[model samples]
Target chain A: MKKKNICITLMFSLVLGLCACSQESDSDRPERSETEVRKEEVFGEGEKIKLRGVYLNGDEVQNDIMDNYIKKNWTERFPDVEIEWEGTGDLTNLLKTYSATGDLPDIWYSDAASATAIINAGNQLNLADHITEDHFIDHYVNPEALYYSDGGIYAVSSGIDAFYTPAIYYNKKIFEQYELTEPETYDELIQVCQTLIDDGITPISIVGTTGWSVRNFLFFTILMNDDPKAAQALLSNEIDFSDERVVNALKKIEDMLNMGCFPEGVANIDFSTHMALYAEGKTAMIATMSWGYPELETAQDTGVFMWPSSNPQVKTGQVLQIWGSSLNGWAVNSRSENRDLAVQVAEYCTEQEAFRHAAQGSSLNFKTENPAEVTSELEKERMAIYNNAEQYIKTLHLNAMDSAVAAEFATYTNLLLAGDYTAEQFVKDFNPIWKENTWFEK
Target chain B: MNKFYTKKGKLLFALPGLLLFSVFVIYPMIPQILISFQSHNGAEALGYVGWNNYTNLFQSNVFGKVHRNTYFIVGCSLLIALPVSLLLALLLERASAGVRTVFKFGALFPSVLSVTVIGKMWAGIYDADWGMLNSILRGIGMEQLTRSWLTNADTVVPCIAAAFLWQYIGLNCILFYAGIKAIPEQYYEAAIIDGAGFWRASICITIPLLQDIIKYVVIISTLGSMGMYAHILVMTAGGPGDASRSVLYQMYYKAFSMSQFGEGCAIAVIFIIECIIVSIIINKCIAKEPIQY
Candidate 1:
């Protein structure tokens, strides 16, 4: 009994001690409120300012842009400002960790969701007043798109990415041998797939492991079938996922699956595997984003085609979906002593990134023109699709969704692709996720 | 010196470990449990939510699937690992010294490699298009048997278990082998005198003596499976659509990925309770007697 009493006392003391340590105090956090509109402050020429930055440099392309281009130029412009840039694999969790510990960096790279999360935690500095005319001028994507419902700009993009457009990249040699032209409608696509399948070749290959490709396919299909407003309405929770437009789009994907458009066991195919399959000529076509152009450069004679409308009345070019989100870029830490300098660095990086996008000739939403001739044929074809688009629908779902809904969106879409859920089942299962996570003000 | 054995002195010796465990393990659990009953947005707690988080978790469709996946993999690893390890240990016990050395190294090799390397290697083997498994299937005229092993919802959990079992099977064998070596040769000799073959002797003598070690392995294996997250992350990222998510992966996804820290903490709390219950059940069911050998 004495021993039990002693043990209880010890445990109680431990709990009590931990409670004191774990309870967060507002006094511990730096006091800053709302999006502060500040005059442009000049930095002292001789004064040493050191800024720490965190960014996602996991991808080689992003790494090259940051290290060789952005950081390089920033050093040339602000030689006195010492910037320590740390590359992180998982930026969201890292920033969250920093936010909880009250040690957030001067500036960090952010996506829409991460920025929203940090802003809600009151750890991010809003840059609404810090913007210059250069941020809005000659930009295909209006800077207004970056504004939160509260009218605060938290994150700013460098430029628009070719990641906006989803296209079916086909092997030209195979298509030429089969005497098949690019399919202009949904029925025509199915017939082309059938012809490819008949010749003992897989019609398409997609990275099914990550679910993004499959989700893009479904979203683009929806864009082809429904009005741009209806698509936006679905994302804004104005309509249920069980709505006819979404259901019909899911059915079309299911039809593609049933028609053997995708290879057997496609779900196991990852990015590398699908690329290999496409490069090896095992699949006649691959459905992926225009950002995949760099990776597909080595492939033999590839051609690009936009997703055709399933409804014959809806012209293919009448509405085009662009997966552009302004919520991805640099954000300033609210509590930083060097907040102004950090914002300057972030702004510089954003501008340089825009310049790089223009150089690549794939800046879909940015009005920045390519300085040189567009050399890559596939890029040219992607340009043609962009040029032909009558209406450009920004993919608001990517920016508006909370993390939970985004994850479930991928899961349900991947399940649909795997044939584990029928179109009706996908709609029924996904409606709640849509409703639960759709909290953004329209 | 005499004072060192006293209760006060003994407690002094244990203080460091106690403090370390409390700081690293027990201390975090308190806030974690607290967070489980609050609405957390990853970085900060919003307010008290009572049992709402738990109710939400139980009501979630993915929750049941993830739990089922965890149980299936745990069950699979135990069922497949135990007998194979036992058999391997028994076989190695009678083998020549050089062969034993070679086999032992071969068995332990997978365990020595990092989980990332093992995961990637197996992913390559299970690759649908050009993986060795499919290649072999096609080569052997068993082309119909080829599958995207890690992606198929029906086969993903088992495949993950197989990868896990492959890594640990050798370690289990080495453990059993050590236990077999410790057993007195006199028992085997007596069994031989009783007109028993090697298999019969092993069934009677080796099996009974191994209860303690077997219980230890079972506990670790069960707990290990309960906490598995890396292989799933590396191989599938908990997809082919949440079909292969383990309980721990669900916890991670809920907290870090979904930013539902309260739900994540709820899952963690339940996971801790589950591990405790399983340990108790295992303790009661096996190694009833402390072998005096």
Candidate 2:
């Protein structure tokens, strides 16, 4: 009887242990249905391809439009091709790393002028055969903008848009309360700001912490009051920043700050806070880019006008140089296995149809003309600016110079806004870096 | 024959762990040390520049500011957090079992959250216009004091260190609490009988016994405070003119953002050396003989 009881206890314990082992194994196994398995198998059949892209945070070009459209269209168009998209921040560094690793993406998007480093590194694909003159003319409003060294088409340009100046976005409710007319000139704008301040309202909500927004106020004014060619020449090392135009512009911004046009703690205010101040009618005006319209439109009773220039002669003629490029396009990666399929997808996205779709979705696409569905008055004003391309000057940072120089410019601008450096000092700091990194000799 | 077999078995058992430690820790450190001497571009060696990278770093604004900021933050964290944690640990040790468990669990809760989440939450709390702290201050009619906490150079590091204390105090508390709990009941009973009051007993018995654990905690926390990157990155991005930039943060920015791998590696080497020197000095100062109960 004692032996039988011991045997039973041992047998029970063994059975329990086996049950526990089976339970653990079952938990470890990944649960998938037969249909899910089949779907994954079908999806896996295509020749796998990945494309790496670098994009800006506020652009909404890649994530909102291109990625979504490609994912939808690629599988239908090419059943055997699988395209994977890897997006990266900080385009300048990303491209440099890629060049270092020799792991350039199969297809990538980069600014044409700023791509000199990659081109110098011998990593860029020569798309001369892929792009033709007729294609260029049809796609780009100004084909000359796409020109690069070696007289070969390394990349294609997209449709051109007019440059955007730093615009004054005012709260309409505040303006109506003060019975203020839209200021047309720099002096008038200053007077109106003073009036608003006298009426117990903060004159301008400057998000100086953003650095770029503060820079826009400084850069646009300088470009407007100064000779364009001279300013460009100075930036390109043809002249010096110590010139009167640059100095006067810097002085004007400092003068404006001293005049109580900006808030007490303007330098500490971030973009969101500035916008909130405008929305709540605490401030009369805020300076920002054309791209900011989409976000600022969410504010109550918002209105925008071009920033007034100090030079009376050129005030009307001067517009904020569209600080970046219009040549946003897709490229097929040289290392891609499904190069043909990737090119097809790229072409499809850049075509007129995709532009129309993008326009309908409240995004500005390069190829498409004005879409009728863009009912917002602000967008209508933006579309007019886009149509009148000759009225604006294109400041080429994204497409005109090396990206490292632009990043340095951004840093200097930040220092200037932080009151750590003067305009002359800013220029002096960048001159050597530009000489070292760029093709410019001096 | 049995002794020889046991010795062989022990060696065989220890081999795998030793191999892993060498591969993961000892071997990788060799490359890190070597990379410090050569110039690089994020990955590959650009060229050899012995001490040039380090020399340039000394001349740069980022290095001096980061060094000062790291030491300041570590100092603040140690000065404020260590005593608070010890006090909490002592108080909990004197409580009932149920109360002790509750307080211990409460203290450990902050450690459960990731650093990124804590940073973001504090950012909201410290926001100039819409932050909870500012709102409370305004309600109390201290609106003049409402300023951008993270952007102001004078306040940013201390603000970040305060957040660090909140996140880490609980951990230290739990550790010291465990150490205190591990002390035998007889020691405390003898002290009480010898007319030792609570404070006297703690200073004489509890603190001395917990010295090793305290030393370890201080060293680790100091290193952690020096190497703080993610909180600053996610919250302020070492912004408002590099007010909160740490050495590690600067190294990461150079390597990942600017693609100056040579400078970054150089910064890393210097940072490691600083940490080592600091740890050694602390160990020497705080080293104590183990007490026999």
Candidate 3:
């Protein structure tokens, strides 16, 4: 009995040792074959060039209008080219992860800052050689809009220009009832706000919790009161954030909060509720971008005006501009066998006719010629803004900084919105780090 | 002589388990200790940074806040959850056999649901715009008292702890109930015959009998609270400026989001040591001789 038990225990130990060894070998064996499979699967379409494109879906032109229309129309136009569209969550992070894995799609859309990072990481193809001087005029593209870094064109600017305006999008009925005209200046706007408040309306339904929306107010104040070049100078370290102009901008926001211009519990209200309050006519005006027009169209009788600024020199309709990169353009993967077909398909999609169609759906792109018909009134209004675009000054935060610096900016903004750090403290905390770590030396 | 050898052989049969414990648990711990000495980016090992990571952790404002919040939450959960579960278990153990089974099964219902689902349900209940709690508060003419419970730093931790308590109370109750039922009824009968009242019998017979189960519960509960992750991640997301960020959440953020793998490993190593120390202290404080009866 004793010998039998000892023998059983020894057998069990030997079996366990063999199992663990086999498991280790099995795990290690997959990688060699897996790489071969991945390479063949990703690049195996020899004649049929299937270009995968990832885009965001929403009411915005990129999603609701541009992507949907492209999916429907592009297939009919290009019978030979197979375009596979995949909508992804968190486009920036997805692209970054793809770049890290070296399994990037043929084409992807990203902001200028992210584009810079992708280029720095050596994943993006240089398109300057492909794009001729005549192509800009022929395609009705604005040559100046293409982003240039270190004196070389890296990405094409999307024709759609988000001409950001910190405008008072007021209900026409409410404005008329309160006897309010388009406020001529910042002080006059304050007076209009007071009048609306006295009439039992929440003056401005500013969404403080949505950091981006709250930031628009700050951007507007800075652009209007300070020099237009102030942002660029600060980013380049020519001017400090502690400068008088920046401080004044923050103080103005504080003053606005203290004056009860915004609704009570504005800090807690999210973007949806803020819009809902405005849409329901509980609020007199909402300070938002031109992108807000589609949502406001459903609300009763709305009109837009340029926000009045403290500086008279800063022109009316002049607001902060967040430009989209043409770098979001398509590129054929070097490893792909169907490279020629992919390039041909990319050219066809970006052709004048398709560009015009895409422009109609989105407000960002500038069209070479006016479309035969404008589908939405908001589109028509946006087109008018683009036609008269020389009147407005453009600005962007992340686009102006290095990729890493821009990420830091986003982090700091999140921190500021959380109320853990004040705006002034945020600038002080970041400026030194920005000066030290930036790729751009003074 | 042959029978003695057989009994010794039977004792040696536990060797496989011991070997597994060494390989899986003990072997991996060696690498963790080594990783604590290195600096790591997301992709590659970035050489030793001495004690920089630890020093940085000590200096961080958010880390200090998260540590305090975690202890407070754990303390509050234990104070309310443990006593209530014990009482419920004791009551159910004394009931009829059928009633005892039904109660035991019913108590396990919440534990059947995933932590994510429980978190979502609680978030909805506490939502500022349309939460049931705020709606009820408003209906009772206490509208001013209604606030965004999850967003506020003062109430967010307690609100989350209450959710944790609700989810785990059933499981703990079942554990205590099983422990109580396992005890022989002869001691209780003898106590009753000796003119011992219900309270006195409970203190002398029932409580002492549950000493082992009580020790196990305390150790498990302490470890569970220390390593709590899923509920906080799904519900609060360490939000409102890291008000309810626990050590596990911070460790995860370091490993995945920030991509500081070495520091994350270091955190895990320290966390294990802290848990062990805590367990030892608790054992010492509550040490008692086992009652064979």
Output per-candidate TM-scores for chain A, rounded to 2 decimals.
Answer: 0.85, 0.75, 0.76
Score candidate 3 by TM-score against the native. 0.71
| Candidate 1 chain B lowest-lDDT run of ten | B15-24
Q: What tens-digit string does per-residue lDDT give for candidate 2 at B1-293?
A: 56756745655565566555555555445556666677665535656888888798999876899989888889877898889999999998888999987887888888888888898788878876578888999999999989768766788788888888898899999999889988998999999999999999999999998888989889988998888988887666676656778999888766655556777778878887888899888888784677776
- Root mean square deviation (Cα) for candidate 2: 10.4
Task: Give a tens-digit lDDT track for model 2, residues A323-396.
Answer: 54433455544444344444555565455334544455344324456544766787667656555534455554
Cα miss at A352, model 3 (Å)?
13
Residue B177's lDDT in candidate 2: 89
lDDT of 1 at A96: 73
Model 2's alpha-carbon lDDT is 0.65
Model 1 earns a TM-score of 0.89
TM-score per model over all chains: 0.89, 0.80, 0.71
Please write out the lDDT profile of model 1 over residues B1-293, one tens digit for every residue.
79899777777687667766766788778789999999988766789999999999999888999999999888977898878998999999999999999999999999899999998888888887668989999999999999778778888888888898899999999999999999999988888899999889898889889998899889888898889999998888887888899999999888887888899999999999999999999999999888664
lDDT of each: 0.78, 0.65, 0.63
Assess the local accuracy of residue A392 in candidate 1 as a C-alpha lDDT between 0 and 100.
70
Local distance difference test, candidate 1: 0.78
Error of 1 at B249 (Å): 1.6
Better of 1 and 2 by TM-score: 1
- Using Cα atoms, each model's DockQ against the true complex is 0.53, 0.13, 0.15
Q: Across residues A1-442, which tens digit of lDDT does each residue of candidate 3 receive?
A: 7677656655565566556634222235333223234445655644334567655453455564445555667767765456677676456556655654456666555445345445655556565555563364245445555545454445443455444454557788999987889786778888998888777778887665424554444553454444556655654557765677765665566666667787654544556667888899888888776667768878858876656657777654454444444455444343333443444444554553245545556543445454456666654665564555344444445434554454444344434544435657766876664665444542
